[model samples]
Target: MKEILERRYTLTPFKKEIKGLKDAFRRASLRNLDSMRKRGFRPKNISYYEEVILGEKRYEELKGFSGRIIGYFCTFIPQELIYAARAIPIRLCSGFYDTVLVCEEILAKDICPLVKSSFGFKISASSYFELCDAVILPTPCDPKKKLIEILSDYLPVWVLKIPQDKTSSSKEIWLEEIKSLKERIEDFTKTKLTRQRLEETIKLIHKRQTLFRQLYEIRRANPYLMGGRDFLLVIQTSFYDDIERWIDKTEELCKQLSKEKTHFKTDEKIKILVTGSPIIWPNFKLLNIIEDLGAEIVCDDLCSGTQSLYNLVEPDEPTTDVMLGAIADGYLLSSVCPCFIENNDRIDRVLNLIEEFRVGGVIYHSLRLCQLYEIESHRLRLILKEKKIPMLTIHTDYSQEDTEQIKTRVEAFLEMLKR
Candidate 1:
C-alpha cells in the first residue's frame, strides 16, 4: 500500500497508471449514481438525467451534435451566447475525489478541491474535457483565475473577468466583457451571432427556465414529491444535457411528480435548506448525509443547484444588444455567489429560502480551502442565529474520509431540529 501510494504521487506517473485511475473514477461515479438512484422513489422520467450524468447518453448526443463543443467553468459564463453561436456549452465543474488526488501532483495542496478536480480532468483527459474545442472561464475567485492560466495550455481559453462589486460601472464593464466574449465565440465558431439567432436561443432557454421553476415549485410539497439527491441530480445533469431534450424530460418529470403520492409524512422528517459552495455531482456526500439522517433538503442556494436555474433572461427588447445585456445582468446581478464583495444578497437569499421552504434547519456546506464560501458562512450563521434558525456548517473536500463524521454531525443536527 505504501509503495502504491508513492508511485501514484510520483512526478511522472505512467500512462497505464493514469488509465487505471480514470477507470477507478468512472466506477466511483457509477456507484454514487446507483446509490442515489436507489435511495428514494425516483420518477421514471428522471432516469434520462442519470444517464446524462453517467456520460454515455450525453456522449452519444454530443457525438451527433452539429456545433462546436464549448466547455465552460462557472455558471457566470452566458450559455445563451454559446447556443446563439451554434455551439454546445458543457459546464466542466467536477466533484470526483479521485481526480482531486490526481491534481494534487500539480496544484498546491491548499487549493480548493473543486478547482483541483476540474484541472485533474483536463490533465487526465477524462470525461468530456477532451471533447471541447474551446473553454470559457469566469474569474470569480483566485483559484479559478489561476485555472485559466493553467488550462490555456490545453485549449483555447476565453477569460471572462467578473467584477467584485455590483454597481452601474461594474455592469457596464461586465456588459463589455460579454460583448468581447460574443466576438471571440463568433470568431471561434465561424458563425455570425445574428439578432434572430440570439433571440431564438434566449426564448428557448426561457422555456427551459420555466420548466426548472415548475420543478422547484413541485419540490415545495410538504412531503417531498422528489428526494433531494434526485433533485440535485436533475439540476447537475442540466450542465451537460441537451437543452431541448432536458427541458422535455424535466417537464415530463414534473408532471409525473404532480400525480405521484408523497412518500413521507410532513412531521416524519425535518425540512432542510442547504447553502454555500457548489456541490457538484458524485461529491454528494453532504447531501446524502443530510437526507440519510431523516431530513429532506427542500431548497438550496448553491450555484450548482437552484441558483443556476432560478433567474431568467428578461430582455426589454428583442434586439441582440438588449438581449445580451439581459443575459449579462441575469448572470452577474442575479448571482448570489459569495465572491462578490457585498454578500447581503446571499444572506437575504438564504433567509428567503428558509422561509419559503419552511426549513427547520440550514446546512452551510463549504469545500476545504474554499475561502469565499467559508468566510460568508460565518456572517450568514450570525444572521441565522438571530432569526432563531439552526445552521450547521460542514467543512469538507471531495474525499469520503469524512463521510462518517458528516453523518454524525448531520444526525445530531436533525435531532436538534426535531427537538
Candidate 2:
C-alpha cells in the first residue's frame, strides 16, 4: 500500500533524470525564431509567449502564494468555476518533442503524441507540472480517456464527464456534470461557489472571450497583418497563463491590426481553413509548410485555433443555476470537436468558417492515432465536395522527418487550388 501510494505522486528513476527541462523546451521553440523574423512576424508582440511557455516566470511569482492550482487537459473543463473557487486553472496539454519521446517508452508508442507529451512533462517534474494541486481531465476522445487512466496512477486526477453529442437531452446531462465538477472543485479548494462569485467569474471569462473573438475576426479581415503561427501561439499561451494579460495583449494586437492597412498580393496564395487536432505552439510545422507553399490560413476551426473562443456565456436569468447552465450549454453547442457525432456541429463550424473567411481550400490535418479527428475528416471531405470547395487531408505525427513529404503534398494541393 505504501509503495503504490508513493508511486502515485512522485517520479521513477528515469523521469527524475529530466527534471529540469525548461531550457530544452525553450531551445526547441526558439529554433524557428529566425525564420519567423525573416517572414516579418513581430517579435515584441510575442514576448509573453517566450516568457511563460515553460512556466518559470509564473511559477516564481506564485511560489510564495498559498493557493490551489488545478491543471486541466481539455477546454471543456469550465475555467470560470476554478477561478470562482479562488484557484487557478492551467491547461496541461503538451507539444514538446523530447517529452513525447520519453512518454512513448512507457505509454505505448502508438498513442497520440499530444497525450504522451503531456504525461511525459508531468512525470519530468516541470515547474508548471509541480504546481498542480490536482488535475481535471475530461474524456472528449478515447486517447485522452485512456491517458487519464494512466495519469491517475501517478498524479491525483479528477475525471470530468462530458456528453458525446449535442442533443437537448445530452446538454441537460452536461449541465449536471458541470454542477458536479463545481462540487469537486469546491471540495479541492475548500471554497464555496457563491452566486455572486460565479456570476463575476462568468463575466470575466466572457470578456476575455470577446477580445479573443475580435482577434479571430481581424485574422481573416487582415491576413497580412497576422500569420497563423503568431495567432496560434497567442491562443496557446492564453491556455496556461494569466487570463487578463492575454486579453490585454490580444486587444492590443487587434487594435494595431485594425489601424494598420497592411496589404499583401493575394493572387498566388490560396486562402485555406485548417481543421483538426489541437496544434499547440512550437508544433506549428503544418501551418509553416502551408504558408511556405503559398497559402494564407485566414482562419481555422482547429481546437487550438479560433473555434474554441466563438461562443459567449450569456445567462438568460441572473441566477447561479441559469449561469452554470449557460456556461455548460455554450461549450456543448459551440464545440467544433468531432467527438460529438449525433449532430452536425463540426460541419456547421467548417462551412461557416469557410464562407466567413472566403476560404478557397480546406486542409484537414488529423494527427496520427487521434482516431476521432481522423474519422471525421472523411465526413468533412464529403461536405466540402458538395459545396465545391477544394480540400486536402493529411495524417501526420509529431516528427519533422515527414516535413518534406507534407510540404510536397501542400505544394501540389496549392498548385491545384491556384488552377
Candidate 3:
C-alpha cells in the first residue's frame, strides 16, 4: 500500500527548466560567501574552507577521480560505511534559496525549503548532484520519506529506515539496516567492505571528529576567538570536503586560532546559543543578524553544528558486526533530532550548552514548514522558561522576504538580554 502511494507521487510530471539556475545560484553563493568573509576577525587559512564551501575545486577534483560518488541526505547515513565501500559520501542537504524557487514549480509551495532546495539541485543537475552515482536517504521525517520516491526518478535512491524510538529492539533493527546498507554500498561500488577497511575508515573518521572537537574547544575561548558564521561554514564544508583534507585544513585553522588573542571583552558582547533547525550556509540570515547586532554565537544545538560531530564510534571490538553496532548507536542513540517521539535529550543538550557556553540567551530557529522543529519548539520554550533562560523562536523560510523582520526581532531579543 505504501509502495502504491509512492508510485502515484512519482508519476507527477517535472518540467526541468534549468536554463539560468546555475549562474543565479553561483552568484548568490558567492555573494553570501563574500558577505561572511567581510565580517569578524577571519583566519588566514579561511580561504581553504571558502574554496571547499564553494565546491568548484572539489567538483573539478571529483570529475577525474576513480571512485564512485554516493550522495546521502541527513547525517544518519554512516559515512564510514561509504568510505569502507570505496565510495565517496556527499551530504545533499542544501541551503540555496534560489533552488527553492526552482523547486516550487514541481513541489507544493508549502514544503520545507531545505527539501525543495535539495530536490531542485537534483532536477537541475546543479552542484554535486550530477556527480552522484547513487544516493542514500534516511526516512527520518515525512518530507524525506516522500523525497525518496521523487528522487528515485532521478537517481538510484537507497532508503535507510530510521527507527523513531531509541529502544534495544530498535537498535537491533538499526543494526540490521546498517548491515543491509553495507551490502547495497558494496554492490554499488563493486568493492568488498573488508573488516580491515571498515576499521581503518572508522579510525580515519574518528580523527576527523577529533579535529572538529579541537575546533569546538577553540570556540569556547573567552571573548570569542572565531565568529559563528565562520565556524558554521567550516562545518558545512564537511558535507562534501575530502575527509583527510578537511581534517588537515581544520587542524591548521585551529592552530592559527590558538596563537591569536581577541581584544573584544567578554562583557562587551552577549553570548548567544542557537538551537533548533539546521542553519545550512548561504541561508545564514539568522546567524548574520545575531552577530551583526554585537552578540557572539558561542555555541549551538544545531545538527548542522555541534550535534553532527559530538559523538564518536566506540566499538567494543574491531570486528565488523560490533563496529557496525557502534556506528548504529553513535548515529541513532546520540541524535537529538525532533523526529523522535521522546526527545528530552534535546532539552538536556540545550540546557547543558547554555550553562557551558555561558549563553545569555537562546535563539530557536524554526524553518517554515519544518513541522518537527516547530512542534518541538513549544516544549523547548516551556523548559527554558522554567530554567529562567530566555529563548526567542524565529519561524522563517529560505527567502529574504523576512530578513528585516528577523533582524528587528533579534535586535529586540538582544536588547532584552542586556537588560
Predicted structure with the largest TM-score when compared to the true one: 3
| Clash numbers, per candidate | 0, 0, 0
What TM-score does prediction 1 earn?
A: 0.93
Per-model C-alpha RMSD = 6.2, 3.5, 2.4
Kindly report which residue stretches of model 3 are placed more than 4 angstroms away from their true locations once superposed. Answer: 1-17, 261-267
Tens digits of per-residue lDDT for model 3 on 40-122?
A: 67888988888887777899988877889999988798999999987899888888888887888878898989999998887
lDDT of 2 by residue, 1-419 (tens): 11112333544334544744778777667764444555654535677665666466777865665898889886788888999999888888877778887777777788889998888887677757677888888888888887666776566777777787787898888898788888888877889999999988898999988888887767667676666667777777777777888788777777777776445435335788888888876677788888766577778877777765667888988798899999898777787777776547778878988888788899988899899888888888898899999989888877888999998999999899888
By TM-score, how accurate is candidate 3?
Answer: 0.95
Q: Judging by TM-score, tell me the better candidate of 1 and 2.
A: 1
Give the candidates in order of lDDT, highest first: 3, 1, 2
Model 2 stretches with alpha carbons more than 4 Å out: 1-15, 41-44, 62-64, 262-268
Clashing pairs in 1: none
